[model samples]
Target: MNMKWYEVAKIRMKELDINQEKLAEHLDMTKGAISHWLNARREPSLDDIAKIMKYLGFSEFVVNHDGTISTAGGNENVSNLIPYKPGKEYPVLSSVQAGCWAEAIEAYTLDEISEWLESDAHIQGDAFWLKVEGDSMTAPTGQSVPEGNYVLFDTAKEAMNGSLVIAKLTDSNEATFKKLIIDAGQKYLKGLNPAWPMVPVNGNCKIIGVAVEAKMRFL
Candidate 1:
């Protein structure tokens, strides 16, 4: 009989002398959550499973081409072992479309979308992709999101201090991308480039979503 993904992970952890607490620490998750997953009390998301496999120094849990996850070993037939579904495909919206996303999303169907991109991250609620437009987010050092890249935004995520977000100004119809900063209870939209000026967030500013991932394409 083929071992389950969690069972394999448990064996690997024992060999590596890593306990549940240590694995949780390495994965930046809670020990209780890790315990639940390993004990079969709860199922982990596909992304979490991937993270666990990565930290365990193997990639036995693999995503098949048909969007099913399976456990693989030498000379073993691939089979769907995980009960969870695959990651979702989100529409790639233009800046203008993203600016009016709330209204636009309701008006169009998934088939109407020109382009859609898939992500491996476990997302809650609705999500979308927006291409980077300008150099305002480009910085000389530290974390930088350069122009001509794609950013995946999660609408359900709360906008926290120092989070990259897509914002809309009530005074204007277009959406803008910037880093969110909260200073002394006051919020501000700041660009990564030092030369760019920071825009104060007030009644007119609305945070559309928090950026979850950034990807670059070379063709």
Candidate 2:
């Protein structure tokens, strides 16, 4: 049989330079439990699997009825990073932390990127990328900002009262995409979907970064 899911996770984790102990913290499990998982002596529960998917950035890899995974296009850009070396920590933000449409979650770089842009607006601070997972912000006319896109972040930009932002509900750590409204007493995180009236995405949601630019694939 192909390597078990746990084993596969172990391999990917190592490739990302993340250790078992660190991954255990993300999974809310003990070190020994992570060991058992890697050894295939233990298995994660359904809820655990979902959390692991989020931690591993595999939210779109659908789980089949047979317990097999279907590798989809969800993690298309997980391979673009140049790999981290010593003395580097990328800012890890949550999606719905920054976006007009696509929310950002994590920064994928080790150093400050102030020199990579064509202008001053491209100066990257403590910001990064979070893979987009939904289409609630898709505009019928703006297919250019396709759903499931990645937005580059800049943590330095102050979140203004009415800017579109990535936010999370304190009740839910999972990130979301929405418009940000600072209404004196209560901040409202507006959703583009009229079906679901805009709520406070900033009040509870963590602000990961302000979007500098969005990256998506046309292919």
Candidate 3:
């Protein structure tokens, strides 16, 4: 019989010589929440599962074409496991170019791009990297993406409530990055910083893509 996800997690935790408290600390979650997840009282979201797997020292997990997950670095038979492949490389675009991304992509070939970055994130459709310019998205506490970091955006991903997105406003020539918030039937673009005012998503505002990942540069 196949082991359940929680069972696998428990076994891994035992091998690593850590209890739920330690695991929760590493994940930045409360111990009660971790307990609920491990006890199977609640289900973890896809994002939470990814974080747990990553913190447990699993390098990668493969989703088979048939929709089955294959855990890497396991004792399972290897013949049927899919081959591991390196992450895809995506082009880095300027804020102005990203504002008119559809047109820019059509105009320039991949070879014409001067810089490219690799990401292991599972993304769909066209994707690109954009360097953050200001402190609008930087927060004083909790989740934050500071200025000067590179954010990866996927055009095919659906932008949901609380998603980070790249957007183009009718009044601006450059694209803006912010957290997307949906309340009732209305949408708003919120800056993570408390001092920054939120912007309403009007007819003149266009969502470009959802941000999938962010990377910080040392130099």
Candidate 4:
């Protein structure tokens, strides 16, 4: 038998950057079993072929053209957009602290982020994982932000004057997640709690990224 069914498996595995061994793991199979199909020493059963096609997001119908059979879907015409799923984990590597954060920490990602005003419709930006620290901005928002709310940072966005943001202070080797205040020739980091003082900023405060969203896991 030609046993060309393995061709479909090979194509999907290469296209997705997934290996046969990994695919077998995803399908809860032994490596030796998958090795047999790849080596063509033994043909994959109908059940195995069905599982492979489904995992590749292809329909069950295999089109017949001469001796060549093709899968219904060949990973074409798909939007190729990753659907946003909140609470899903993503890597957190600090671009600033290159040495310290080079090893990307496994962090959970948030699906969507809301503006400071709590309007659900105003959200716009790409999701990034960030670590929040310090107590500088405590006047209005940092209370909920907490000391370590793995923030979902995004700068491709818009906000009001008093909205909270994660900004980097050039002079000091640190970034402050504080409320934004832009005035005539003066920029300051506003604190949420009135008791805390609002620190003045200079041309050094770089808006690295805004704290657009967050993921807090309470154990």
**If scored against the real structure, what TM-score would every candidate get?**
0.61, 0.41, 0.59, 0.42
What ranges in model 2 sit over 4 Å off?
1-121, 141-145, 170-172, 201-203
Candidate with top lDDT is 1
lDDT of 1 by residue, 87-111 (tens): 4688887642222223222326777
Candidate models: Cα lDDT each: 0.72, 0.53, 0.71, 0.53
Model 1 gets an lDDT of 0.72
| Model 4's TM-score against the true structure | 0.42
Deviation from native of the Cα of residue 115 in model 3, angstroms: 1.2
Q: Please report how far candidate 2 places residue 162 from its true position, in Å.
A: 3.0
Per-residue alpha-carbon lDDT of candidate 4 for residues 72-131, written as tens digits (9 for 90 to 100): 554332222112222333335342221111222322433233222111111245545565
Hey, what RMSD does candidate 4 come out at? 18.1
Lowest lDDT sum, 10 consecutive residues, model 3, at: 98-107
Model 4 clashes, total count:
7
Note the residue pairs that clash in candidate 4: 86-111, 138-192, 138-193, 139-191, 139-192, 139-193, 140-192
Question: What TM-score would you give candidate 3 relative to the actual structure?
Answer: 0.59
- Best by the TM-score measure: 1
RMSD per prediction, one decimal?
A: 9.7, 17.9, 9.6, 18.1
Question: What's the residue-level lDDT of 87 in candidate 4?
Answer: 32
